[model samples]
Target chain A: MELQFKSELTISESGFLFDHSTGLTYTLNSTGQFIFRKIQDKQNAMHILNFVMQEFDVSEETAHKDLDDFVRQLKEFDLVSR
Target chain B: MTEKKAYSKPTIIRHSVGVQNKFGRPPATVPINRLDGFEVSELAEKYGSPLFVLSVKALRDRYRDLKRAFSTRYPNFQIAYSYKTNYLKSVCSILKQEGAWAEVVSGFEYDIARNIEVPGNQIVFNGPYKSHEELTRAFNDGAIVNLDNYDEMQVVEKVASELGKTLEVGIRINMDLNDPPWHKFGFNVEAGHAFEAVKRAEAGGKLKVVGLHIHTGTYVDDVTIYSRAAQGLVNFYSYIQEQLGVKLKYWDLGGGYASHNTLHGAYLPAEQTCPTFDQYAEAICPILMSGPFQAQDAPKLFIEPGRAIIDEPFSLITSVVSQKRLPSGQRGVLLDSGMNIMSSVQWYRYNFQSAQDSGTMLEDTIVYGGLCMNIDVLQASSSIPPVRRGDLLVIPHVGAYNISQSWQFIYLRPAIIAIEDGEVYVIKKAETRDYVQGFEDVPGKFITN
Candidate 1:
């Protein structure tokens, strides 16, 4: 599945995410920030999983789970659209 | 190339108003690697995941401690182990070895006592329903069968006359002690049902009323309830003697003693709220001692202790099946054990600890069982540290009602091991598909199809 971040959202290198439309701020861990940046760069779930596995010492299953969890949370916050 | 740092799952925590502060206090967690000097990992590897471990020493000690607390205060006292709480043969055998009489509520429990070689005279039969055959058997075996209602009194009278025996029986009385009254099992004293039942039993020539039984309720933390119930039992005993001219031989104050397991939604832990065994003895024994009856005429005191002696002596160890972040930004952990085996989680906030140290950061997490149902949650919310798949979680104070109430659901039940003097042995074997299917017989037509 593909995801696009809302245009009004602003993200920082320090793992802070802000949504101008909703006035809501979300704090991300380093892994969440990495996945969020990948999603913003128009990367798909497979590419994000690969990137997470290569960037950290995690198995394919764990990286996939993390990517799925991150995308689900993004959808729940309305920070991204399908 | 340098090695990459260890990875934890990505988390996007919503920083919104009224959101629970994840970083409040340090995680109330400590690694529970060993229980009763046995390694939890070793036990799980040996028996299987989701195993129950019972301490034989704890069982004997709890029974002895409760017995000492009451027997020292009241001279003519007997502790009958309540079979319904946990009727594991090993557990019952240990209590029986400690001189505890069997307190059974059903024919199945009575059969278990008899199978364990507990003599009928040492058993006190108490329950709401007793079949005519069961009453005949109990009467023939010389068990102290307590009548729950008037119908039971008539059945007992019939059985006694048919066998040409003057059977000694007891009547269970329920009264409003201001605590939650258990009116379902016994005749209500406040409503005069208890007096009427006793009078009817006296009118029946074959049945003799020799004991008075009252079960206040289950998990009673307040000592004053027992004091009031004891006082009520004493008052009723005196009335029976004056009006009916029958001297009761025993008073069976049925079990409701609370263990040190925290009840769900309670402000304080059970350790802070529940009265100790000594405190309960003090509340009960004083009233029985202070009764107007002389030393020679004092009634024998019987307290059926189920949870108090059984709860703390057992622990359940389950392995983490998986972990994930829920839509609410909370951590969710799925365990190999479920509501099928851990049924008491509905009422208790059981003490759960990790079998190994995972991390120091505490997170808001919900513990789920492996069951497919939505109600299979073991813990709705717990502030625990990060746990990986296969990590063991130890749940203590689960000895009461869990085994007897648990059934074969989706997953087969696990084994239970007993540890004593550093030696561990299986009290119950893990269930297998064949064992579960052994009771079934496929029809010939279905097999042909």
Candidate 2:
């Protein structure tokens, strides 16, 4: 599925994310920032998983779990939509 | 070439309005690696996970410390280890070796004491329901039998008449102590029921009333209730002596002392709330010492301590089965242990410690047992260090009711090991399918094997 984030959502390099529609603020860890940056660049879940697995010394299962959990939280907060 | 950075789970913290102390400083995680100088992991490996590890040193020390606290203060004091708390034969044997007499409340427990060769004279049999056969056995064996009601008195009188011997008995009395009273087991002293029972027993002529017993409620954090119980029992003792002219030789202040395990709703840990053995002794001994009887004719002050003596010596070792994040944004971890084996979790917030020193990224976690039932939660709210699947967790202060009340529900009960002088001894073997189904009888038609 195409990973789509809110059009007006603002993100910073230091892992600060703010959604204009909900006015909710979030702080992400470095790994989470990398995934969100990929999502903001309109990357798909598969590409993001591959990027995380390649960038960090993580197994495919760990990278997949992290990507899924991050995406779930993003969807839970209405920051991302399919 | 540069190495790739280590991977940690990607995490996000949402900052919402009115959220105070969001992600507050994680509580320090002090892992419990060794118990009695034996590695918990090694013991778990040897005995299997979800095991019960008991410390013989702790058991003997707790019993001795409690006995010393009372005997040093009051010269005529005696301790009878209550059996219903943890009726493991090995546990009872240890206390027996420590010079404690057996205090049983049921026919089964009485049988256990007998099977352990605890002489009837050394057994203080106290409870409401004692069958005629049990009473006869106790009386014939010269056990200190405390009659609970008029019905029991009549039965005892009949037993004494049949034996053609006048049997000495103690009447269990209960008073309104303003702290949740245990009026179920004994005759009510406030309502004059105890006096009436004593008078009836005396007039019967077959039973001689020689003792008065009272048991306050269990896990009594307040020490003053003991003081009140002592004073009330003493007053009743004097009244019985003066009015009925019956001299009492025993005054049993039954066990309800709190252990180091925290109660469910307490704000502070039990170590801070529970009264010390010295405090309990101070609350009780002074009054009994200055009672209506002199030193030479002083009534034997008997205490039946089960929880305080047994609770701190045992620890439960469980392994994490799986982890999940619940809908409420809380961590949920499942363990091989459950309410079936650790039933005392209903009344206590038992401390769970990491068996290994995992990093200190403490998370708010809820621990569930392996049971399919929803009520199998071990800890409703806990702050624990990050533990992966198969990581060992040790729960201390579970030696009291966990074993005696443990049920062989869905999972077979685990083994119990006693660490004595740095050596491991298996007290109870893990329940196998054969052991669980040993007593079952299936119809031939229903069994298609």
Candidate 3:
């Protein structure tokens, strides 16, 4: 499955994400920013895990656990659609 | 190697028209995470969630400030702690320790004061519903029970005659203060009923009207209202002295002082609009000190300031239970508390802040209490930071009636913690299933089901 971000959103270099549709703003941490950029590029769940395991010094299991929870939270926030 | 990132919930907020932009200045969004140096999370974790954190220092300082404000201005002034505002044993004990006379409204509140052994003469009893037994006991104990209506006056007279004791009491006089008259409590002074009642009671020869009490309204913010109410009572004081030859001992200006909580739909926050203690003292003290009452003969001033003195000393500590997006695109946050816990939120827009740093996004969020009913809302469109689940929240200005008015409905009531001498003491234990059901009896016939 692919994760796609809505087009009405903007992500800044400093991890500030603003939704133009809702006129709302949010801050993303490093992990959240990593996932948001990957999902914007239409990365699948496995590609996201592989990226966190390399960028952050985390084992494959920690990356798998955190990225799954992060993506599910993003889905809950309606920032991304599956 | 990279460090693990501190994660907050993935959050989205919509800039609605009426949510954040409100009331010129934004609502009080002061970041308050602790009460008297004790972190909110520590109190919640140790005692329970939805707890009431009361500062003993705040209570003493408020009472002393009010006492100084009035006592320094007027020659004689006495404060009676109105028990109905908050009758927790610990609160009452602190007030009594602070040199406050107990003002109870019911037989139950009177007993609470007495159980703490507040002097009977120091206790002022005022309410509409008083039984014959309660009045007899009040008079016997020399408690200054104010007569509310004719029935209560008759009860006092009957009991005084039967026990062969001359009763010295006060009468709560209701009159117009340019607002609609409150006529249900006592005899109407405007309609001459107060004059007639005093004469009749004096003629009965058993009840001596020692004082006159006037409680015009609640949340009384106007100094003019207080001035008018005091003037009206003073006029009656002169009338009673002129016609019946009785020198009134005191004037119980009943409590209605407003606190710093903003009222719903008010243009100004109560901190700005509500009259200060000094203003209230200046307005009413001049009236009592100048005319008719001599410098030495100024009838002692007795005040029952409930909310103004108590509202600031305590706060309700609750936790965010869940978050929901309302259909109207507003953020809906549910707290483990609601009207059941913070009952004053029904009228006042209390200040709520996240116990921990939730987020910087200051948005208008609707807070709901942990109840199934719709009226269980704590704040309607309060400007608060994005609160994450399990993060504790502190809501202030709840010291007045929240505890006294709190009920056990969907969930049992929460614990009450009073910060005394820099230590947390649970003055009231959190209600358990058995404590809530202790008085509930299951009939034997219905138990089979």
Candidate closest to the true structure, highest DockQ = 2
Writing each residue's lDDT as its tens digit, candidate 2 over B1-449 gives 56787676676667756523533322447899999999888888888989999999999999999999999898788999999999999998988898999999988999999999999899999988999999999988889999888888888989998999999999888999854667897789889898999999989889888998898988887899999999998788888889999898889999999999888877677767789999999999998887887887888989999999999999999999988877766678899988988999989987778888765445567999999999889999877876778889999899998899988898889999999887889999998999988999989889786
Clashing pairs in 3: none
Collision count of model 2: 0
Off by over 4 Å in 2: A1-58, A70-82, B3-28, B445-449
* lDDT per residue as tens, model 1, B379-437: 99876666778889999889999999999999999999999998998999999999999
Residue-wise lDDT of candidate 3 within B42-65, one digit each (tens)?
888899898998999999999998
Q: What's the lDDT for all of these models?
A: 0.87, 0.86, 0.81
Chain A TM-scores for all candidates read 0.91, 0.92, 0.90
**Candidate 3 off by > 4 Å:** A1-82, B4-6, B10-30, B440-449
Candidate 3 chain B: minimum summed lDDT over ten consecutive residues — where?
Answer: B12-21
CAPRI tier for the interface of model 3: incorrect
Q: Least lDDT summed over 10 consecutive residues: which range in candidate 1 chain B? A: B19-28
Query: What's the lDDT for residue B17 in model 1?
Result: 84
Off by over 4 Å in 1: A1-82, B1-27, B178-180
Assess candidate 3 and give its TM-score to the true structure: 0.86
* Model 1 CA lDDT for position B89: 97
What ordering of candidates by lDDT runs from best to worst? 1, 2, 3
lDDT of 1 at B122: 92
